[model samples]
Target: MKSSFLKKHFTFVFFIVFLLFSFKASAQKVRPIKSDQGEVVTMHSDILKEDRRILIYAPKDSANSEKKYPVIYVLDADNHFAQMVEYSKYLSRQDVFVIPPLIVVGITNTDRNRDLTPSHSNVDYFGKSDTTANSPYKNSGGNEHFFQFIQKELMPYVSSNYKTQPYRIFAGHSFGALTTINCLINYPDMFDAYIAVSPSFWWDQKFLLKLADKKLKAGSTLSKTLFFSDGNEDSSSPGSPFHTDVLKFDSLLKKRNIKGLDFEYMTYPAESHMTVPIKSYYDGLRFIYHQWQLPPVSDEKLNPEIVMKHYKGLSQKFGYLILPDEAYFNDLAQWLVKKPATLNNGIKLLEMNTVNYPSSSRAFTALGAAYVVKGEKQNAIASYKKASELNPTSNEIKSRLKELQK
Candidate 1:
């Protein structure tokens, strides 16, 4: 009987312990994988007389913490912010380094009609005036004030809070595109590049089209990059004025041959008014930075000086000191180390990275690997030591150092 009682007690105790362990395991927290996409921030705007929201998307690479990125101020943030962020992130990847990682500041709208429209007009897009009490055009023609908001309030706020370069891009769509073109003509110096996707040139009876004709003079010097596009708005008729107006604007810019004005116009016949922005934004970025990318070349022709020269020209154009990305240099170094002739150049490029990015453990690791390839044991050990010091938790660095030490 006592054995029977003891067996029952032991079973109950084991069951309780198992239940406790299960409960404890269930209660334990799991660490979540965090995304470095971006964050939304708010600021009060005295120029607009309202609070504004700005979405900022930055590069995820923590190694380039000290790097200052070019800023893109995009209008109609509510509709296009996510798309821009994704595009910037993907296009600036190390594998597809067509464009540098950009800081995209998406400006959310409070009053779309008022802020985006350049002139107050009772007349709508169809050339019909709305005299009703609830007319949407009642609060239009605030583009100047909107520009002031961006210049005085928004720009200062972004510059103060973020690591931004002097180079800036202005991007907008439809009505927002109209504002961008207006800014381009009136305030050319505000941005280095301008992107207008399906601009509503038909607004206020084509006031902006006439303004463009007046502002852009023949043989005039307007040293800026401009990319504008139009989509198929009226599929029923190819001769519709919706697309014709854009053609007129394009012709006006082209015929004048405005000195220093770099511009490209694209037409997406398959896309509609709302869908054109996706392709146009992508093409616009590619067009503006067409010269920024380094073309692929044979390993024999690869030279660090050539890389430096390319970036120097880019720096001159951007009006800022630009350096080749750490990843780009590192990749070039790795490629160079594979060949006997380019081994020294590879080491040199890696050394340059150590100077440019002193805090990067991966840079030092890559340099160490290059030194190992060159049969320089002591140099490799030193580089690995520096890398290990920077990243103490890295088992790969630890193993590399151990293997080299042996």
Candidate 2:
């Protein structure tokens, strides 16, 4: 009886081992999902003497092979990186058509109080200083060094590694907003645009407001875009100094009439300080790209030349060679191809896209479709062949080419 029991136990153990091995093999066969949103990059900052983690989000468009995107550098990335990424992705969609695709560079903070504040004051928000060892503002007043870290270390790294345009935007909130204003006043040429949400203007007894009044001279040619906002911090009280300070800043800008300085001010009475970033960011983006929307092109006046001229104007404004988005142009071409009056224009636009995005299989395939619609059999076949060569794995292109050839 004992020998028989031991034999059964050994058999059970052998079965368990086999099951474990099978499970291991099955786990190895599974593949991980690949993310194209962006990646986390770590770099050592010589200016700050610390390793910084930057979050980058680039648009996933193969047709933008030769195109460069504008970069937005945001502070306090840990709290707002994902929001900014989502905003850029959604607004820049071909259908939404609100803004252009942007490269969001989120600079994660190592020390928020130290890196974000402009002045090294131990005084708290209530105008009282805590001299205790546990005080959070001990390492404050590092903004100068932080800006150096960005200008000298971080910007160079991003410019070298990413497909970036000459135009750049600086964005921040609360204390970060104060830092942004400081940069604007001291280093005005650092960024082409600025977004400051709920700036803590009360910091160090409204130091920044005084500085802005002194620095931004009347009729000065600033040639920059600024979007700033304040939240419902005063509880609807007319005497709320927080809101008053922002108003003062706004009044100063208006009085100065600084030439070339395109500025907008907004007050969010419904949103608190923490909840204000979302709406402010959306409005800020719209204001900055107010001139980006293409004019209405009806079926009667579907002109590729009009589109080209608009983009050329945009290119000059942005100080870079900007072209119409490939997907936008392709969708326009497809729509135009259906109308006999606009069919020729559609074909011309597709041809232009193929030239602008030479390596894009989608562009070539789109051109081929337009040719097919025009009954240009030879041109259609040639375009499809080139597309198939560019994207060897595209069975759809191969199938279409075979049908055309036959």
The TM-score values for the models, in the order shown, are 0.86, 0.86
**RMSD values, in order shown:** 6.9, 6.5
Write the residue-wise lDDT of candidate 2 on 1-406 in tens digits: 9999999999999999999999998888667876555789999988888899999987766655656789999998988888888889889988888789899999998999999888877788667887778888888888999999999988998999888889999999999889988998898889999999989888877888988988999988898899999899787555658888889999999999999889999999899888999999889899999889998777667666887899999888878888878899899889989998989988988998888778889999999999999999999999999999999999999999999999
Give candidate 2's error at residue 165 in angstroms.
1.6
- Lowest lDDT sum, 10 consecutive residues, model 2, at 58-67
The lowest-lDDT stretch of 10 consecutive residues in candidate 1 is: 58-67
Note the residue pairs that clash in candidate 1. none
lDDT of 1 by residue, 1-406 (tens): 9999999999999999999999999999999987665889998887787889889887656666777889999999999988888889889888888898899999999999999999989898677899798999899999999999999888998899888889999999999899999999999999999999999998998999999999899999999999999989878555559899999999999999999999999999999999999999999999989988876766677677777888899988878888888997898789889999989988988998888778899999999999999999999999999999999999999999999999
Error of 2 at 155 (Å): 1.1
Best by lDDT: 1
| lDDT, each prediction | 0.91, 0.89
